[model samples]
Target: MMQFHDAAKTNRSSGKVARPRLLAAATWAGTVLVLSACGGGGGGDAAPAASAQVPVTLGTAGPGDAQNHLPLAVGHSWQFEGTITEGANSSPTSTTVTIPSTRDVGGATALVLRESVVAGGQTTVIEEALVKDANGVAVLAAADDVLSKALVPYWELRFPLTAGAPFVQLDKTGLDFGEDLDGDGRNELVSLYSSVQVVGVESVTVPFGTFPTAVHVRRVLELTVRRSSDGLAFDATETGDAWFAPSVGWVQRKSELVGMGEKLSSLERLTAYTPGSLGSAGASQGATSTTGSTLATEPAWRRVLRASASAR
Candidate 1:
């Protein structure tokens, strides 16, 4: 039997009220948009020599903490090939997420990130900022408008990761989305719930190479959008899995959404990546930053495209 965790709608941060609530789908709510693209690649691609080593062996897939397992550096970039699956239809997808630069926000030095998705002869790009302090990595607001207040910053990854450990990322959060749908010139209310956990360590092989000690993480997102004015309601749920290698960043990811009266899925396999120096690259800098950040907190909503690049 499949066990479904009761995703609660509690605020994970300080409780503050916004004059007008906004829908997060435009930004962070995107974590669940693509899930059903299906394809298969059983071939192995050659990768560069193992010149890189896991700096901190705290959780050597053996003993250590996962706080530093993910490396985010400025100028760091990764391109992924995704496949989306619908009832008898499948399509290929390509996307890239990069840290453009770094900036100061609320006393925390954050990284500027942009993710571009191309599929179905169209392109959609989303930009967000994030920072990893003692609390973990969180996505910030793009502007100073009601968004920063209406929508809470989305947390991409959490810390102290241990095998078989579980934690809720976002509580049952309810807010009114400022976007107008149905061409009725009215915003709708969206209820959101999400959570992530470190499943364990495993050896996974991808186009990049074989990682013997990759951390397996899983996430689930559920939302309900309601328009009290027109009596419209939609319910959706998205689940995702990702493998992260220490010193390296995200090696691969898979996501699926099975609600909202539709099926959408996506897979992100690292095709090519250059983990630059680890701070957070904002602009063009010759030096590499010393930390890690994600390309898109939400790369959902798009057709799937497939392409492979020779491993470097």
Candidate 2:
């Protein structure tokens, strides 16, 4: 993720830039929400919402199902081109996601997806560890050059995709990004609450090709940043919609961030895809036992935040 200082330097000259705190809050919110790639499903005790019609079961053709919306095979890669617009300024950006290998995450074999993003002449790379089972895909850990952290296992996509059935993606508090958001020379603690739902299935066209059966998923995120010393807080909301093609993976995505007198939007479309040879055996390995496993209840970032508060 881009640092808060980088963002400040990028938009400092603009008269329409938001307040210092709001700018940092919005930037951090976008980094966390938009950077995480696609998929949606229910987790833990959360139940799927009722559907008016029969729910569509995706990738149900047994092991190595060719119709799986998200293929976790090594060597699979996706390229995207997009633009980010804030105020009247817009910049071109590109992203590439690839599954370089698989590693054990919490005793489960998980695909290591490396996502490289280039925007405004800066490149940022993030590595995510994920596992997929019959239920859906879950993210276990994520890291970058600056920080590495394990996440509370959460479903990125749940099976039997149904319209209007939103599932909780993440509802965690006390996230400290280690950036001085309020300019008090200390980072603030933030909370993230998000949910995802399959809005509909539609034909979506992009540079890669026209996907006749694209599952449109919508994710809504709320980020709250609080300063401990002054008890000041700010809230930001982000809504993202992604289109995933069966057997092809994510095809398009659009997201918008709204906060304290600022709005930032981005749109990305698939430009290329490279399929991997590894089949179901690679994807399902060590994934079975990880289903519903709840070893870590709190994220490492939250723990750090709690410790920081106590020390102060």
Model 1 off-target regions past 4 Å? Answer: 1-67, 142-149, 182-185, 278-312
TM-score for each of the candidates: 0.67, 0.68
The per-prediction tally of clashing pairs is 42, 4
C-alpha lDDT of all candidate models, in order: 0.50, 0.55
> In model 1, where is the ten-residue run with the lowest total lDDT?
302-311
Kindly list the per-residue Cα lDDT of model 2 for residues 1-312, writing each as its tens digit. 111112221111112122133322221111221111111111123232222212323335424323677767877888999998877899999989777767776576777767777889988665666777676766666643112242245666666565786776665444444555445566555545556688888999999999998988777654444554554444455677888888788899877754445557778899998887565233533322223222222222233233333324
User: How many Å off is the CA of 64 in candidate 2?
Assistant: 11
Q: Which candidate is the best by TM-score?
A: 2
Best by lDDT: 2
- In candidate 1, what are the lDDT values of residues 206-277, reduced to their tens digit? 888888988888876544444434434344556778887776667788776543234556677888887666
Off by over 4 Å in 2: 1-66, 144-151, 175-187, 279-312
